[model samples]
Target chain A: MVPQEHPLEQLLRSDRMPHIWCPGCGLGTDLGCYLRALSGMDLDKVAFVSGIGCSGRAAGYVAVDSFHVTHGRGIPFAIGLKVANPELTVTVWGGDGDIFAIGGNHFIHAARRNIELNVICINNAIYGMTGGQVAPSTPLRAKTTTTPYGNYEHPFNFSYMAAASGATYVARWTTAHTKELTKSMREALEWKGFSFIEVISMCPTTFGRRNGFADGLEMLKDMKARSEVKNFPDLEDTDIGEKIVVGKFVEKEKRSYLEEVKQWR
Target chain B: MSMKSWQNQRGFLFLKEERCKGCGFCIDLCPKKVLRQSEVMNAKGYHPPELYDVEGCIMCDICTEICPDFAIYRYRSKERGKNA
Candidate 1:
């Protein structure tokens, strides 16, 4: 028998049930947080754009005006959408690899330009969609399909990078911190000019199993134990290692790209 | 309280067993310890969670918050002023 629609069904493409995400993958949780963040807001005014990855699939599931853009192109698409229709709330959602690897240049330049865009980067620390490859955000000594022996390179601290690149708002949260993540998402949506939120998610099928966590739950518990909520800290101290520092790292007012363009006219 | 009496409570928890992938996030995060992993596997070969102690559930909705698959959620009765 078909079950009754869930309360959050209105915000979801219900026909896309049983999403392709694995049993314990945190992308679903992240999507839930994003939807919860959109609660009480004007859903019609929202345009969600996502790049190719596990996180990118969220565009298909969300019952909003959404676009499943090409790899590492979510930000550019969002930028175009926002510029064309400044009234719409534009958000770019994609994985760490999509945002920080192939899209890394776009990410920083958008932040540098202080564009009026909400960017949600789901950091699973690996390229989960394309078979667990070593990503720019992959932590050192972590095993991925490509980094079989262990990742020896340092990873980018996304919150710090966002702040450094001139994002008006920046925050970091893990999947286990649902309430905080939801709050951050809401705040990011409300903020203008390159709001970047780095969500530390788990890919049990790839990053988690390749590392040590047996599944998503174990990874979440580990995150819970290692996470410390501090309002702000030095960018150098924001590295993800044995302990992860999570919180609102930066929130400032600035002239957004749209506003600046209007002034130039 | 009796099972029948508990059924009159303002809040109820539902588990869409068929949709559950048995990740156990709901069970692990339930503050009241009201759920458990059922031995019975669903069509997906996953052990869907079951309510073990409904009386303890205060309808905090933590399970709903933590469920990655959206397979679990809480429903509050429209009857006003009753304990949730």
Candidate 2:
């Protein structure tokens, strides 16, 4: 009877009822969407790969076949999985530091090659797992353990980076936009080329407590209020100061990296 | 007066039908039996969950807590004087 339940729901350990995420953490919602999407898909055809970090925990929670890959190496692992079994739907999950910092080169090339894999970047704006360290996504002047005085470095616009780097499908959605995030994820799964979705979730215990967000709910509500929904080009530079712009910024079809490589073969 | 009157309060919980994948997490988790699967398919054709007894709400807020998507919200009834 339990087996008849939605595969993803059944896959989860209800006994593990209380989740590890802090209350109001968006990662749980992202996991929910991932489970829902995977429920509608063929379970036998799915494989998830993730690098080290809080975001990497997703691979463990998911019931599907998944890889807990090394730090900053999730993308390559997923690429290898897909290349070996083109029929499998592979997904890579990682934090901003692991993927965009240490694994930066692989990330760019993965996009350039257009590997047909779904990449979910959980951009919490700080290195959450090890402590609230400064990350590539930490906004200018935001405080972190490494930058207690406030970080002066400009953060990477992950969506624009992926879009410009030749990823066929690119989008950004905050944890607050659950519906849009879920929709974008579903769309990303259906895409034949490289798909990237940057999810802005909150790290309550570390980022929130340290940065005065108080709790996860406060962070989620604050982000919901501050995030502006807009087209990429229509977004004004001035608005970036008031709040972060969030939405499905890009979705286009291009020659997939897998197909391009096949051409040489 | 009728069954409708017994279910007239209409809580703040509303499912964005196009977004709900009919995973039934909401249905399985509602503490007050307020939500049920709708017979009419929504815009996305998924049988999104719906409220069964709007007037029967004790406003426990458990559904909102269990919801991973944060898709549900509990609002204060205007007649309740003190909002929850």
lDDT of 1 by residue, B1-84 (tens): 001112226466776777789999989888778778988887789998888777777777688888888888877664456544
On a 0 to 1 DockQ scale, where is model 1?
0.48
* Candidate 1 global lDDT: 0.87
Looking at candidate 2, what is the lDDT of residue B18? 45
Across all candidates, what is each one's fraction of true contacts kept? Answer: 0.61, 0.13
Q: Which stretches of candidate 1 lie over 4 Å from their true place?
A: A1-4, B1-8, B78-84
Which candidate has the top score in TM-score?
Answer: 1
Q: Model 1 residue A199 lDDT? A: 94
Candidate 2's C-alpha runs over 4 A off are A1-8, A13-17, A232-240, B1-84
Number of backbone collisions per candidate: 0, 2
Cα displacement (Å) at residue A104, model 1: 0.5
Listed per prediction, chain B TM-scores read 0.79, 0.62
lDDT of 2 by residue, A26-72 (tens): 67777876665666788789888989987887777777897998999
